[model samples]
Target chain A: MSPSERHNVTVHGPADGQPMMFAHGFGCDQAMWRFVWPAFSDEYRVVLFDHVGYGGSDAAAFDRHRHATLDGYAADVLAICDELALDDVVFVGHSVSAMIGVLAAAARPERFARLVLVGPSPRYLDDEGYVGGFSEEDIADLLESLESNYLGWSSTMAPVIMGNPERPELARELTNSFCRTDPEIAAAFARATFLADNRQDLERVRTPALVLQASDDAIAPRPVGEFVHDRLPDSRLVLLSATGHCPNLSAPEETVAAIKTYLAR
Target chain B: MTIPAALLDESAEDLFETAPCGYLTTAVDGRFLRVNRTFEEMAGREREDLLGKRRFQDLLTVGGRIYHETHLAPLLRMQGSVREIAVDLVRPDGSRLPALVNSVLRYDEAGRPAVIRTTVFDATDRRRYEQELLHARRREQEVALELQRSLLAGALTEGEGLELGVAYHPADKGLEVGGDWYDAFWLVPEETIAVVVGDVVGRGLAAAATMGQLRSALRALASTGFEPGALLEALSEFSRRHELGQMATVAYAEIDVRLGLMRYACAGHPPPVVVEPAKPARLASDGRSPPLDAYSFWTDRPDASLQLPPGGMVVFYSDGLIERSDRPLQAGLDELLASVDELRDARPDTVASSLAQAAAGTTGSPDDVCVLALRRRPART
Candidate 1:
């Protein structure tokens, strides 16, 4: 399948506008950017897509070997950019995807103009001098929580959770398949996300970045975000007053404001 | 048993405190705004200890905190309400309480997320049940894998002037055993050998079982001195009589190395490819018939013969060899032909591995892929 089809690429905004691609994190699909992407749609060419095996992306395109590492997801981001012929792109990534954007930017620095990493952590496990705020046991417990929540992921209930109030007809026709990833794929993605150590990739990135850290993020705490900022050659950190990991969802206004301020500067 | 209006009014506060399920209200950022008696009891803490002092996430295990931040929080923001989220609540003594949580994100008059109202249900029993189901599914996968491994463990036929190689790759997505299998054994030891690649319908343990039955039936029928066509005809009869492996596809070939002759027949399968010395590889599409138990009007199964020149090679493979979701079958076949031609100089084993690797590119095949290559050694230098 073509990369566009494989990733379920969706485009919005003016054709000739500067490209702004939003990448969602581990827990959800492109829908995670619903509140934030619209804020940029007027001035930027917005691109949104689900990662393989998530949301609207073709599940068959999920190759276990390819997606076993964050590099594979980084390759997919580049593939999307290549398919759309996007350049000077402004990438806004959440949680794990923030690191994906990091990898992608480091691989091809010229393609990206700026990166907005929301709640990013170069690594989730604590290192010798760094504080990642989680232990190996914590991630294992998260996997167990995912196991017990399979009932919430069932086709019957996923539709209810993913329902589009404005388009009830579309919801009915989707068979509740949106975000219906196989449980195995979910676990593999979790491992890849939580276990990844991309601290060194930061040095290779030349693209100027904005780090949007939540005030009390349980995932990417303050020090981790500061570490990402310190590693990147040209980056600024903005700690959002919003608590929790997903400031985009909890405080889209603040998230958008932070990106707007970064781009304007 | 209806209560009086005055009594109902007085009992409203009692209902909130003594509800069957734990109920609480928290600020949008999870700071406890209010808690009922039931929620306090379930959390093993008093309202005074929780209210204004801790966020709901603080009451969860570390993993539950991460899950709350990642999945639960975003889901509540998007859907306005989330249902039946599994989490573990940490009590003061550190004992874990498996809980099912549901929360609604309520917006205020200014259209801002003002508060989150949540209900918590004790799910120790439900959690155990889910764990059992997960274990059972994994056990089933293991059993299917074991069955497939034991069945395909037999050694292939090998001898002087004959080179044989086989590669089998199961579908990688779920690690479920597929129906595709390859078998090579002596029909008349040292003189002629039978090499077969077949695909039974479906997957999992049942498909593995069906593949085993069909493999045994084909071997048994070949031992009766039946020709390639008759062997398949009998196999189809076996399938119909016993109601197993219906619509299974097979490509059966018998090679007599000394005589440089091959009798082959394809039963609803992609024809085997042949590459002669210094000649381009071509598909042997001559003898073909519908799948077993297809119930076609034409009952006759014809076998075709090919003169295996010195240094010639023949490969029998399941449909996965020439079928992928991303491309047309003809395209895949063309690629296979080109690949065989490119790898013509390689050994039989190298060619088998290379072809299988090429077919399963970066993304593994959804269906199992099997390749069995047989080459007649070139005239001794």
Candidate 2:
């Protein structure tokens, strides 16, 4: 379908610089990248937007079944890339979006220059031979918390759910209302994000990838991070001494520095 | 500045005897050679009754006695020290008390095991805390259910110009009702009507409370005949004063029954879907302005004229209807748009029931879906 006449997107940054697409996690919108954007905006064309239901987007367009798969989110990323006419794009996803970016890259490897996955996981569920750090009950508690108040969970859980409980605002700082999303949409996302097994998809990620890991994370532990690194054919793992699911919020400078160091090469 | 090893070793007996933790030394034959005041307090017996008479195993509860006879003593004999092992002791009154035990075997000069010294601490507070946490979660679940009931009540009220129907389903059994809401009621007889579907930031009681405030404010401002934008502006002003960190997105539909036309406004919300008998594509609302409360140099249009057939239904809803738990909000919207024709495909006599069916149960619902289905009830020809 042609772009909706009412839909208009503005891409602002250096026109000829390395382009990067950054996706936010649950409970947040594109604004989560604000602090990290300043470090690269002068040099790179940065892309950010609320997920369809969140932020300043149209909410009525949201559908439950179609979006139950991460591939749908992956398709949205590619659509945004296509709209911008981006090539050799450096795709960066934070938290869950990081996993979405990996799936997107695996689908269309040629469109991406490198994949910068921050706190990414192939699957959150523990398999017979695999450990995802959290048990079923742990995720149930998290879902219950999210259902109670996504913002409250983000603010309160950011401390314990992330590596550091001291900086609770980091959770509050990264959130966006973009999806203007319904609780139903959030619930669907939670089930798809947590219960779905995507271990098979990691093997197809052929693009040179950088897994910028937080030393301590509540959702993605070192083992899960390493599992992603080991599975991706062309990847490097760099664990920074950051303590949160959102490194972009917890350690913006260090995260930016890592991005700078990786992109520079 | 530090005490010498010999002095420290010699003073260990004095320190252990006076330490806040319960300490006791048992012989190889299981007789208690020494017992501290802390141990005496733990057992509810005097040191004189305990020392040189009771065995370490005798103080353990029945289950603890079995565990000690089969597992603990053997483990401690093999490992030298077992720190922080949880156990239960039977006090003199036969009340079982939970505790954590740390023990090490004392050695003679030649390194032979002479006696076993153990330390125990009360774990009642920790156990109580765990129980309270479980209870708090249970109480929260009940509160979430109550919020859901209130969210569903009076959500769809009919007015002179409009007929309304709404349904709300929290994601799960005990989830807090999210901020999604749909409402249509007459604030001023046939002259004016209020129709709105808006989403407050976050979910649960806080969002529900804010929803009530915003919804009530809209109704309060409705009689003044403020246009949708002006109405939203008033709401924004109120929110700014209250300093609600969360923002709200709303789509408002106002009908002037006497004029036979309706005006619509959108603020950071999805456009309302206008459904007619046998026509789906023929109906759609123009979306404008980002949601209210996020400060920007944006203005809202007060009116857009629309001819209404008496039996036509205009659906006003929060994002929950089309929201997918796992996908971007847009994808969910797209899916919803694709299924818009389904609303029209139903039997005309049962359209109201069909619309209710769409949102009745949340099989595919990820969030709370609030839809206000309004029918003009065309003239009886």
lDDT of 1 at A161: 37
Model 1, span B339-377: residue lDDT tens = 989988788888888888776655637777899899998
Off by over 4 Å in 2: A1-265, B1-120, B126-152, B159-162, B173-177, B187-192, B203-205, B256-260, B281-287, B296-298, B345-367
Considering the two chains of model 2, state its CAPRI-style docking category.
Answer: incorrect
Residue B75 lDDT (model 2)? 43
Best by lDDT: 1
**Positional deviation of B135 in candidate 1, in angstroms?**
1.0
lDDT, residue B302, model 2: 54
Note the residue pairs that clash in candidate 1: none
**Model 2 DockQ (Cα-based):** 0.02
Question: Candidate 2 chain B — worst ten consecutive residues by lDDT sum?
Answer: B62-71
